[model samples]
Target: MSIDTAPEPGRTHDVRSADTDPDAGAVAFRPAFRAALDATAAAGVRVHEPGTEAYRRLSGTFNITKAVRPLAVVEPTTPDEVATVLRLAAVHGVQVAVAGTGHGATEQMDDAVLVHTCAFDELVVHPHERWARIGAGVRWDAVLEACAPHGLAGLCGSSTDVGVVGFLTGGGVGPVVRSAGLSSDSVRAFDVVTGDGVVRRASATENPELFWGLRGGKGSLGIVTAVEIDLLPIAQVLGGAIWFDGADLPAVLRTWSQWSSLLPDEGTTSVAIMRLPDMSGVPPVLAGRTTLCVRFAWTGDPEVGEEMIRAIRCVAAPLVDLVGPLPYRQLGAVHADPSDPMPVHEASTLLAAFDLDAADELVALAGDASGTPLVMVEVRQLGGALRTGPDCAFAHRDAAYQLFSIGIMVPEVAQGVVAATSRVHDGLRPWSRAGGLPNFCDQAGAERVRRAYPRGVEDRLARAARRYDPAGVLLAGRGLRTAADAVG
Candidate 1:
C-alpha cells in the first residue's frame, strides 16, 4: 500500500505510503493535512495521521475486502468538531469520507480524510412522543435496548450491530418491513454537517431538499451527526427461521414463492439457500452442507401468524422450526445474520417477478448440487407499506422481490466466488430489473449509483448536492460524481 506519486488535479489518489515507510507519501500533502490535524487538535478533537496506530485501527471497515487506508482518520465528539474537520479538509483541498461502524464500505474512497463518528454515541428515547434521537455512531442493538422497557421498537435492519444513521440514510428494510416500511420513511429529522462547514437541521420544515436526499441518498449529500425517527408500539412479533435439508429446497422454494406473494401486510418473509462452512458457531445439520431456510416475521395476531406459518411448514418436514412469539428485542434472531466481521463480496438485484421459471434458474445456479461457491443466496418478499412512502430519493418501490448473494473472500475461492455470483446475476436477468436497494448496493462507481435511483431522481439528487456540497468534499455515493461533473 504505497502512494509513490502525487495525484493530478481533479483526480483521486491512494493515500497509503510504501511498505518500507508508511509516511513516505505524506511528503506530497503532509504539510496541509498535518496543519489541519494541528488545528483540530487545538480545538479538542482527536486526529490520527497515516503512520499512527490509531489511524490503522480506525481506518478498517467491516467489509475487509474494501478496507480504507485514508490519509487521516478524525474522531469528532461533537457536531461542531465534525464541521471543523470538514471545513479544514475543504480549505486544504483534501477529500472527505465518513464512517460509523464501517459496515457499508465500498472501497471507493482514496486520497481522503476519514471522519470516524464512533464518538457520537448518544441515544435519547422519548417514549411519550413515540420517537428517539440517535447519534450517528449508535448501533441498532443499543436502540433496541433503550426502547425495550417502553414497549417501543425502532425500524432496524437484520444485523443488530449495524449503525443506525447509516441504515436509515440508505432506506433500511428490516424483518417487519412490509408492515413498518423502510427506516428512512420513519425519520422525523436529521442533524448534519454539509461540506460548507455548517451544521443544519433537515426535516419536513427545515432544509427540506436536504431532508429528501438524506433519507435515501446516503452520505453523498452530507455527514449526518444525529437523526430523530419515529418508533413503533410493537412489543413483540412472531418471527424466526425455519430450516430444511437441502433435498427439500425445490419443494420448499416453490411453495414459499407462491405462499409469500399472497401474504398480507402483516406478513414479511424471505427464503435463503446457504452453504455454510463447518465452523464452531454453525449447527451441525447446516454446517458444510447446503440448507434451505425460510424466515418469517408477522406483526398481527398470534393465531393468524401461526396459521400462516403452517402453510410453508407442510411443504416439507423441516429440520428445525424456530418461529414463535418473541419480544422485539430478539428481532435479530429472525435473520440470524453473522455478527462477526469477515471479508465478503456481496451483490444484489431487484426482481419484478420470481415465477417457477425463475426458481428453476436459481436452483440450477445455487441449489445443493449447483456447486456454486456462494455462501448465501436470499430472496426477500417486498410490497405492502414499502410501496407507498413519503417522497424521498429511494427508488425501485415497485419491485416485488430483492435477491442477494454473498461469497466469502477466501484466497482459494475468491475468483470462483466472483464468477459464480456473476453467473447467478446473469441467470436471473430476465426476471430482474435495473435498480436495487441502496443499502445493498456494495459496488463502487457512478454506474452502480445510477441503479439505486429511479428516472430523474438522480438528477434531483445531483441538484441538491451542488447546493449543499459545492466543493464535493463529502463524497459518499455516485450521485456526488454526477453533481461534480454538472456543477464544477
Candidate 2:
C-alpha cells in the first residue's frame, strides 16, 4: 500500500562537488562527494527516519520493538539501480540489509544500508505459460490478486501479507505444500545482486550454482531483485480451521498425528495447540482456555476434501467448525495470525518423523495438562510434494515434519515462558532433524544460519558466495563458511 515515487534531489552545495565527468574533474574530492550524494539518495525510503514517514511505516514481525535503525534506506526502482547501490556500497565498504515485508526479521544493522524494495514492485502473469515474474518488493496478496482472474495461483505462505522474495528465498511452506512443494521449489529464475555488486540472472540454465544456492539458502548469497516461479491451477479451495475444547487436547493431538499421515497428496493439514489469553478480539468460547485447532486445505475436489477433513472434525466434540469452501484470498483468515505485532520469541525444529512418543512429549509440554501459557504450538504434516524434491535447488525436501512454538514475551513471566518453550524443544530433540526451516529460525548467529541448509548444500552456497563476494564484505550469520574454507 505504501509506494514512493519521488524525483531525485538537485546538487548539494558543499565543500566539494562530484565531477560531472569522473575522468576529468575534481578527482581528489569526487569520490567523497559521490559517496555523500549516494547516501543522500539512499535516504528516501528509510522507515525509521523522522521526516521519512514512508520509511517509518515499514513494520517488522514483532512491532513492539523499534530496534533497527539503519544509516539510510534505499529503494531501487530498477535492477540496474539495485546493482548500482550494491556496487557503491561495496566500494564504500557499507554493510547492507535486504528486507521485503519484514516478517521473520531477527537482527538489525547499526549503521548500514538497508535496501527497501517496495518501489521495485511488479507482477507479470503468464497464465497460459503457467508462470509468474514478480518484483522482489511484491507481496503474496498482489500476486494472488493478479493470478486469480486466470484460474492460477502462485505458491504462497499461510499469510499473503508476507513478501514473495523473502518467503520463497527461505523455502516457503504453506497450506498447499503437501501437493505443490515449498514455494522455493516453484522458482524458475531469479535476478539478484551479489554482495560484490554484480547484477546477475540465475536459473537452472544460467548461473546454475547461484540458482541452487538461492533456493534454500537464506539471504546469505545475495539480494534477489526479481523472481519467476510456476503457478498451479487452483482457484477455490476447501480450507479452514476446526476448533475443539481443552479437554479434547489429548485425543485431538494424537488423532491429528495419525490422521495427517493418511492424508492424500491433494490434502495438506496441520494442528495447533493454543492457550489463548482472554481478550476482546478472541472468540468467547476459546478466549482463555487451551484448545485444539485442526487446519486443512484441499487442492482437489471440494467433496473429496470435505470427506477427508470430516474424519478429524469427528475426532472430538467441536467448539467451532469453520472448515469448508472458501476463496483462496481468504487464506489468512484460516489461521487468523495476529495482525498487530508484539515482541514475539519463536523457535522451530524439523523432524525425521513423528511417532507416538513425539506426540506424547509435545502433549506433555504444551497440552492442557501441562499448564503452559505458550500461545500456540503447531505441528505441520510434511509429505507428498513436500517430501519429494523437484528437479530444482531447494534442499529440505526430505524433512518429514516441522514443529513451531510461538510465545509473546510477558515481562513478568518471560523466564517461565522461555523455560517452557525450551522444554518443548528439548522434549523433541531426540527426534528433531538437526536442521531447521529458514523462515522459522530467528536467532541471529553463524551457527543458526548453518542449520538452515544441509552440509553439502552449505558448502555449495559458500562456494557461490566466494565466486560473487571475493572480498568477504558480507557477513552471513553463524558458521558461515566462505569459498576458501569450503575447499579444505
Question: Could you tell me every candidate's TM-score relative to the true structure?
Answer: 0.94, 0.88
Strongest candidate by lDDT: 1
Candidate 2, residue 78: CA error in Å?
1.5
- Model 1, C-alpha of 230: deviation from truth (Å): 0.6
Report, for every candidate in turn, its global Cα lDDT versus the true structure.
0.86, 0.74
* Model 2 Cα lDDT, one tens digit per residue, 405-428: 887787976777788889998899
The root-mean-square deviation over C-alpha atoms between each candidate and the true structure, in angstroms, is 4.8, 6.3
* Candidate 1 structure lDDT: 0.86
Clash count for each candidate, listed in order shown? 1, 9
Candidate 1 per-residue C-alpha lDDT over 1-488 given as tens digits, one digit per residue, 9 for 90 to 100:
11123333553433444654654356335677656656666767787765666777778788888887777688888899899888887887777889998899874665778889998899999999999999999999999999999999999999999999999989999999999997899999999998788999999999999999998898988999999999999999999999999999988898888898889999999999999899999989789999999999999998999999999999998988999997999999999999777899899989998888888888899998999999999999889889999999998888999999999999999999999999998899999987979899986657657778765788788888778887877767445566447645
Candidate 1 off by > 4 Å = 1-19, 23-30, 477-479
